[model samples]
Target: MDEQTITGSTASEIAASVRALHERGALRTGDALPPVRELAAQLGVNRNTAVAAYRLLAQAGVVTARGRAGTVVAGVTAVAQEGYAPDSVLRDIGTGNPDPRRIPDLSGALATAVGRPVLYGEPVIDPALEERALAWVSADLPGRPVRITVTNGAVDAVERLLAQALLRDDAVALEDPCFLASIHTVRLGGYRAVPVPVDAEGMTVDGLRAALESGVRAVICTPRAQNPTGATLSPARAAALRAVLAEHPYVLVIEDDHFSMLSQRPYETLIGPEHRRYALVRSVSKSLGPDMCLAVAATDPETADRLAMRLSPGTTWVSHILQRLVLAQLTDEAVLAEVAAAGRHYAERNAAFAARLTERGLPTQARDGLNLWVRLPVEAKVVADRLMRRGWLARTGDEFVLGERLSPSHHLRLTVHDLEDDDAARLIDDLVDAAR
Candidate 1:
């Protein structure tokens, strides 16, 4: 269809019209969409609205933006995901996972969780879990009243939060070196991702400000132990971000504290006392076990209600059995101590590895979380090839970068905290040699 045939006054309507035309064969693959200004003029709408509409189409994978080449019709391509490659024989150090030996044994907690058979129409969150979780989340948040909601994990909580607050194509502020799951979720949901650069101190203020100015409706932040980089938000940085967000009070802020109890750093939140729309989600996956598959979310009453509607009976409730098990372990002093020690163990292991790299002339520092973000002398891809040849698999930093920000990244994110001393030393030698 030509520009004249493209009709609609609103962003959603315009996107729908374009989709209809494409489905009817009036528009084919590789067809160039009219420029934003031209389409806005034709449709009698604002230029920004047309841009938003185009952005929505792009995020949905219906159209691809080729920079100077302009936007063209293209289908969505498959996205890369995180996890182990079951058949790979190389020593895989790229898998960002908690040390399995440290994950608390759930056998004792499981006995307590299995006693009650939950039926439909019953409460989704276990009362014990709810009480404990509320206290856990509220301790770091503002003193204002907060509501709790249970979800499968941090990713699920984030998905629900964004789904409830934002429409398709709406811009969302995400960290530049963002979590893989966050990147995947936003793209699949058809939401525009505005990258906010992460420095040694979490999300940068200027990057966040630029995103907010671009009319982003949501912001997903990691308060501590951010993935890929392992950068935790410093106290001053948190205050700065909160101030920036204060000016844009209506923007929905979602804080994913995925490395909660296992974090060596303190949690510095972004939610202001008076902010209306926000959520703080802490998952038991990292500290307890990934198999637990449960997270506790604390949010404003209205947001919680909206989330509840989406998680209503018979639809998508987190298992109460899982919730109870988590609560039991959280309350058990011995388990809590063990979890505390595990956190220390991770920190020590990563620090030890970093020291080895530094001593070998490749300066590196262990921040937080289960991995080490190391900068190489040359491109990470080159180093990764060398490592693979040496029988080790590693992830390049470019994998976590958004857009062309870190093209040909000179960094590698290695998960060596779980490795034995000898293996760690061997990998270190290989890594240093690979960089050379």
Candidate 2:
């Protein structure tokens, strides 16, 4: 029998053929494809066409080019979003989840949401929820005629925002040690991620400029309490970033203020008032509870319209009940106080843990957020393994990396807010021993 012909005339066509083969199970994950020259000869196309096809596939997360090891199908898996480690003997401090005890109780708020049943063909956003969400977001947003759209969560809003603005293979500027959800979203959407190095003050201006120069079409930034690193944008840093972004007014800028009311730091924005395309997403997941699954997206009119196309009523609007629940809790004075107290509690606990580690000769900064980003004196994975042997689980910094994996990571992101005082101290001692 004759071998199946890899038929294509252009790069896109060739890439489509490979995708078809993969989907049909003829090409399995980790399987190596034919060399560019050999594939070019087989398909009767130029070698450059084959190269472009491979590059496209790599950008789409369909395959990875391993230099001397050759390109192979990428085994895409759900990134660790932090939850229980089933049947593990260790204490799991790596789960990036807010303590359930701190999450505001919704029982009282749910009772208040009993009203006229929501019907199809109604407005996509709840009227009361929209009013409250706007007031909450407008306090920090630059004065402009911004429109609001409600979504399931911050990640959902971000995904839809990027989908509306960017095309496949379009470059997007993302923080180097980015959020796991953001990384997964960009990769799964077939967009090219341009790494912008972030510091304690948030995304570096030089890095943003470089990414802009590379023709990035969009940028995803976390202005406060950046995940995995706890970096927040300072006023000076925001100004520098805005100055850089001003030149690229049309490029989509998405600011995810996931921590919102729960953040210990002030809200500093990267989107200049005159910027043409921008979205500021504020989610209640952290302050209320992840199960609440509600976020408000304030964006330019055009972007809002585009987003609406995907979230129109009768199609995919956020549940009116969920919206009302979030609004009810947010507006309640007692709930608000509880959320504020929870913020302080997280900050205090993280600071205490960091201080404990510092006294052990392992300096750490617990700046802001539920997790502490600790730098290790040795490789992070080695320390992680050692901690695992001592019945502890920790997340390595490498898992949050975007773009190139050029060097080994020597940092760990630990969620210690849920740990008791004694447990935290024990973990710190074990961490020190492991680091040494």
Candidate 3:
């Protein structure tokens, strides 16, 4: 259909009309749409109305803005995922998963959770879990008021948090080479992602300042054991970041502390006490089994209420049974001790691997979290190819990167905490040869 036939009075109506055309196959992918000014004139609407409609379409992933090239019908963008490659025979080392043996047995916790008959009208959060979770999450934030809300996992909490505070096309500052799920979440939500580079000390101050200057509405940070890079925020750097963030008081800051119980590093936050909007999410998937999908988010009252509204009582509340089960494990001294041991185990194994690599001249460090970020002498793709030939599967750093890189990535993120001594040695030898 031509622009003359594309009719709608409001922005939503216009977006809906475009979607209808896309569904009917009338507007094929790559087809350029009329410019905003042209469309507004033709529809007798304000140019801002047309702009909003285009943004709505872009947010829904139905269309894309190509800068000077103009808006065009866009195809689905493929998102990189974590976990095992299907049916791979090679020794897989890229899966960022915690060791299964370390995950506490859930049989007893499950039994304890079964008797509670949660009803539709009941409070969405388990009272016992809330009290304990608040105490646990509140330890890091001493002066602020914190409210706890449970979700399926950290990813779910992030998605809901963004939804509550942001609209389509809102700019969000994300770490460069971010967590895979965070990258996926931002892309699917149709928000513009401004990458803030992360160094050994965590997110760079200059990078965050630049992002704030760009007018980003939200910022997602990892305070400890950052995914892919294992960069934890240093105390001084954390202070610097908080100073930068203070200028943009209204911008929402979300910190995903996914490795809370498993992290070897101490927590440092970007959200200052007077910050207007913020959320801290901690997940049990790493300490508890991933199957036990549970995360507790501590947010300001407004954010909590917004999140709670989305989580409506009988329909979307996280399973009380799961919450209670997590509570049981968190309170049990034996389980807590086991989790602590698991943290030490991961740190030791990763450290050993780093030592071996460093000795071999690769010069890698054993950072916090479940994986080691190793920089190779050569491009990771080339090394990964060579490693595959010798029977190994490793993830290249490029997969976790946000947007384009100035040069090829020479890094690989390896999950060696679970590797046996012999296997680890073999992989090290293979990697060195592959780099050459």
Instruction: Indicate which candidate wins on lDDT.
Output: 3
**Local error of candidate 3 at residue 350 (angstroms):** 0.6
The model with the greater TM-score, 1 or 3, is 3
154-265 per-residue lDDT for model 1 (tens digits): 8999999999999987989999888999999998888889999999999999999999999999999998899989999999999999999999988999999998998989
| lDDT by residue for model 2 (296-315), tens | 99999999999989997866
- In angstroms, the error of model 1 at 208 is 1.7
Q: Any runs in candidate 2 off by more than 4 Å, and if so which?
A: 23-26, 59-61, 75-78
At residue 245, candidate 2 shows an lDDT of 93
Per-prediction TM-score, please? 0.89, 0.96, 0.92
Name the top TM-score candidate: 2
Candidate 3: TM-score?
Answer: 0.92
- Those runs of model 1 whose alpha carbons end farther than 4 Å from true positions after fitting are 1-56, 72-76
What residue runs in model 3 are displaced by over 4 Å at the alpha carbon? 1-18, 30-54, 64-72
Computed on alpha carbons, the lDDT of every model, listed in order, comes to 0.89, 0.90, 0.91
